[model samples]
Each structure stands twice: as structure tokens, then as C-alpha cells.
Target: MGCMQKCEMSLGFESGSVTSDQISCSNQEQYTGWYSSWMPTKARLNNQGFGCAWLSKFNDQYQWIQIDLREVGVVSGILTQGRCDADEWITKYSVQYRTMETLNWIYYKDQTGNNRVFYGNSDRSSTVQNLLRPPIVARYIRLLPLGWHTRIAMRMDLLMCMNKCT
Candidate 1:
């Protein structure tokens, strides 16, 4: 079964920014949480740190984003919140990963039989099973949106990263 670990790097973001490159990490210590904006441009700022950049392309329509972990490592697991937009509902959601050098994202289910699976359809809360693997390093990670009940904006909450085995 995969274990969960906390991200060692800091997450910094700028409010009202339209691009990821504009999200500065200069004062990495000043960042305490994740930042999301509804700008149509893609920008990310990682002055001295190294990590992946992600943003939800379907803003105001669906809450989703994609990450590329540059390198592969043992991914214990992840915990996220179902914070959809006003009057919106998230019927299904999933987490997927792929090698840093590849373009295809290898789903956890197709990789190993031992994986933690969670489902959130009602209260928007769940803890899926744990996939304990040999630190299979990957480059790309994607968050896919399955269903939307309302036409309002889509939001997510408390998206936490777990243990990263190198």
C-alpha cells in the first residue's frame, strides 16, 4: 500500500494573477497555502525552487488542474477537498500520474493492484485506499473532473500532498 507524505517545498501563489509564471516564489516562506485565480493566461514563477506548475483550464466551469512532478518517486497518496463553485456538485474525481519523460499518464489502477481508492459523491469527503509501491517515480500528475451537477463555478479545497519517496 502507498503511504502518505508531506511536501517539503513551500507553495506560494499570487491572487488575481492570470498566469502561473506570475505566481512568484521569491519569498517562499511567506506562502502558507495554495493560490488559484480565474485569469485566462498561464504563468508560473519559481525563482529558486524546482517543482511542477498546475492550473485549472476550465475556470468558472470546472475545478481542476494538472501537475508534472519532473521526477519520479514513491507517492504515498494525496488528500483533497471537494469545493465546487456555488450550487455545483462534483460527482466523481480521480488522481493520475505519469513518468516525467513520457507524455502518457499511467493511472494508479493500471500500474499496481495495491492502491487506495476514494469516492466523494454526497458530502464531498473521502479517504481512499493506500497504494504501497516501490517509489515509482513519475513526471506528470493530473486531476480529472468526472461530473458536474450545477452550472456555477467549480472549486476544490485543502489539496494536500503526501510523502514523496526519492
Candidate 2:
């Protein structure tokens, strides 16, 4: 949670394997299709459209992009990048998730029992990855931006914890 790092395997945000429908966000806030840009589906790792993949409208902590994994999985890390043509990215974030739709959401906590804060990117284009020591297991994962550089614009990929059989 301290270092902005990287991991090898990704849960397919860049490759479009997760599909646009799986990725969504809250608080879009009346900005409907500004030139058909910045759609929730474009929020993928290494994806650059006009400038960035997804440009979040609001500049608040409550704004979040949630990814429904479709089923429960072990998420070990997350990769983040700033806007392609601008200085916009999430600098810090916290995670919340729930296994079932009807159950209450649980925050990924640290050893101190507080919401674990994961550090994000500083400049645009640099991929910063944070490994979850106690990997999260859930069907729904929400990346809530706690801080940012200019705005909460980002391209991301989720890391699924997988073991290779030898």
C-alpha cells in the first residue's frame, strides 16, 4: 500500500477480455456523452482515445469505478495510469467489495483495521501497481479514489491471483 509498483499478470482490462459492460462507475452526474468520449467502457489499461480512456466528471472522494468480476475471484493487485494527453490520474485509492449483491460491502482493511490506502500514479502514462498482501476475494470490486493529480482520470487493470500448476 505504500509503494506504487507493478505486477506481471493482469485481469484483462487492457486486452478488452473483461468487456466494457463489466466496468461501470457511480456519479456520472449529467454529463451525457460529451462528444461520445470518456465512456465507462473505455476505462481500460493502456487505452487512449481522444486523450484518456475515462475522464471522471467529479473531483470528489465518493466517485468510484466498480468492476463486477461476474463471479468471486481473488484480486491480488491493481494497475493504474494517468490520462494519455493530460496530467490527470488517481493518486490514492481505497477498495470496497461484496460477494453477493444483497450483502453489505466490506472495505479492504489494513493491519490497523482502517480502510487500506493504496498509493496511485503521480504522472500520466506511468503504470503504478499495488499488490494486495491479503488479497481480496469478492464478486464486486470498487476502486474509490481518495486522491488525484489533476482529476480522477485513469486507465486500469485488475490483477487476479492465479497459481500455475507445475
RMSD of 1: 10.9
State the TM-score for model 2.
Answer: 0.89
Q: How well is each residue in 48-110 modelled by candidate 1, as lDDT tens digits?
A: 111112233343423445544434544544333333223333455555667754466565553
Best by TM-score: 2
The window of 10 residues in a row where model 1 has the poorest summed lDDT is: 40-49
**Ten residues in sequence with the least summed lDDT for candidate 2:** 1-10
Q: How well does model 2 score by local distance difference test?
A: 0.84
| Candidate 1: regions farther than 4 A off | 1-36, 39-64, 110-117, 121-136, 151-166
* Candidate 2 all-Cα RMSD: 5.4
